[model samples]
Target: MLFVEAKWLYNDALTFMNDHDINDYDSKTLTVHVLDKDRQPVTHELRYLSSQMRQSVIQGIKNNMKSLATLRKHDRKTGSLKYKSEYLSINLQQSGVTYKFYDKRHIRIQGFKKGIRIEGTNQFWNIPSLEFANAKLLNLPDGYYIAITTYQTKRSEERKYKPSIGIDMGIKTTITVSDGRKVKVLVEESERLKKCQRLIARRKKGSNNRYKAGKLLRRAYQKLGSKKRDAANKIVHELLEHERLYMQDENISGWHKGLFGRTVQHSVLGLVKAKLMKNERVTVLPKSAPTTKYCPHCGKLKKDITLFDRVYECTCGYREDRDIHAARNMILLSGLSTCGTQEINAFGEDVRHWQNSAVQPR
Candidate 1:
């Protein structure tokens, strides 16, 4: 579905409401839903929400603002971008809906006998996590145009593959496979995003210069997100060529909470995880499996191995790249004995039960 956003209209609405005292609203208990032309609940038309929903979402922003303020306060610094002063608006997307754009100015929300048309589409992607609630516009941001669409699948059934591989996500490297192949994703987009953010900080608040900086920052972030998603899609497509995929249940979320938060956040590991989970053929090994520390040949646990140790050296002289070792272990752990069973014993539990499960993109 295509997302349409109208920030200009939203700002105008909020400005109008704020100028007049509309204090009867509670943000926490707000929601929005779409209604058909007959005033009946619409299934796919984007739901316009009430003002209360706007207030509830603002709490998240307020908390973020407070934390940012505290950090800046401790550092003894000041800048533009007034977080608390800024208000929020809500938007929604309709599913299984259709729309026809007569002109660039407006379009229909599509579902009932008559459709709802609104203005603005310039800054659409800014809206996130759109859904429906009831028949009223619950906390929907004012003046934003909406796009209603239906999601469809291009492929009827998932394509089958014969080859299979296991992957290990890493920090220094993008991904390490059991097969000794390495893929390094570019991080230039992240660095550029940071630079844009810094530039935004230098601009004066509410000024044209500041607005320009903000636009630049938004564009940079959008580009970064797009790049990461494209890279992820390509990787998933390539990996699916194999009949099966084995991967460790690495603590990717934990990495985000750690020192390398930037790298982890920008990485497509999370996307990969989601895709794999969706596929039936991909089997995820448990988190407790010693994919890295255990020697594949001698079966000896290398307890002292550190992140810097790229090469896995065992007492039995089974030396290989650490990533390759991990990837290969996935094939062993994923024992497909009868059909195409390549049995390889692991230091952990036998994952033979997974053979019957089809691997998804996750």
Candidate 2:
């Protein structure tokens, strides 16, 4: 009900923005036009969404306007914000005022009198001196989730790290590590997902059966997303244990338009790369670096190398798996290349990095 009312307010506010200033549309009683169960237009009143939530929705419109204007200033092609059929997230504008934590497993929302029991509080419940900030109540297809913004002092332990390693991203195997580890990446859609998709195509459009089928499809996609995220997290955790990681900035998305488009769709390589790059320990070699063509042992470029070659056989008597050879060479190449430092976080709120390099003549 909260999400439905919020969506109504958002669409109503967007409609109002089309004619008048959004700042002028902060009325307590929001009247909007919505389709009825019989597929006829009907007038509806938004009474569930709180004043703060409504303001957040309006402020969202103002923010969109600002973003569009900024894009136009940069001469980028832009489009006006359109009315949405659904609003997936509602900003809890302030911490204590809009929402409050009653206990570890329960929270109270401003519009609701009774406390809502939430299960995932165990994630950050034990942290001492944690201060809650603004948060978003997300209406995911599978369930409702509140993503809270919290602040805590950084961990003071100057940690130990493992020896540095280099990585190679490739088509045959997803990740090849300098330490002789190859991790394949692929997550296929579940049988239930395929069934749900087929069921939707057969259901009549605009009917209740179709609506139910669409909901199931969304749930399946959400489940698929959870699996991909889990797989990416596990892979990232294992790789980031090293002190200084090196990898070329290969264009994974470009590979999507080529022969392995379907394979790329089933793989979590893109997510793994994004998470790895966020860590300061990860060093991204430039895109132009010839990880495969350059040989570390011979100190020469193997210009005759082709995609069909599985083994890197150098004139200097270095014979190795092609992927492993490329992975090892990443460590060598990064030392010769110049790179700037930047700071970046998991959420990409701040973005930058620094990498260790050793000077060696090629």
Best by lDDT: 2
**Positional deviation of 82 in candidate 1, in angstroms?**
17
> Model 1 lDDT vs. the true structure?
0.56
How do the residues 130-225 of candidate 1 rate in per-residue lDDT, one tens digit apiece? Answer: 332222222222223343432333455766675778877776537876555687754455676788789888888878888877877776776777
TM-score of each: 0.56, 0.85
lDDT of each: 0.56, 0.79
- In candidate 2, stretches whose alpha carbon ends up further than 4 angstroms from where it belongs are 30-41, 73-76, 336-362
Judge candidate 2 against the unseen true structure and give its global Cα lDDT, from 0 to 1: 0.79
State the TM-score for model 2. Answer: 0.85
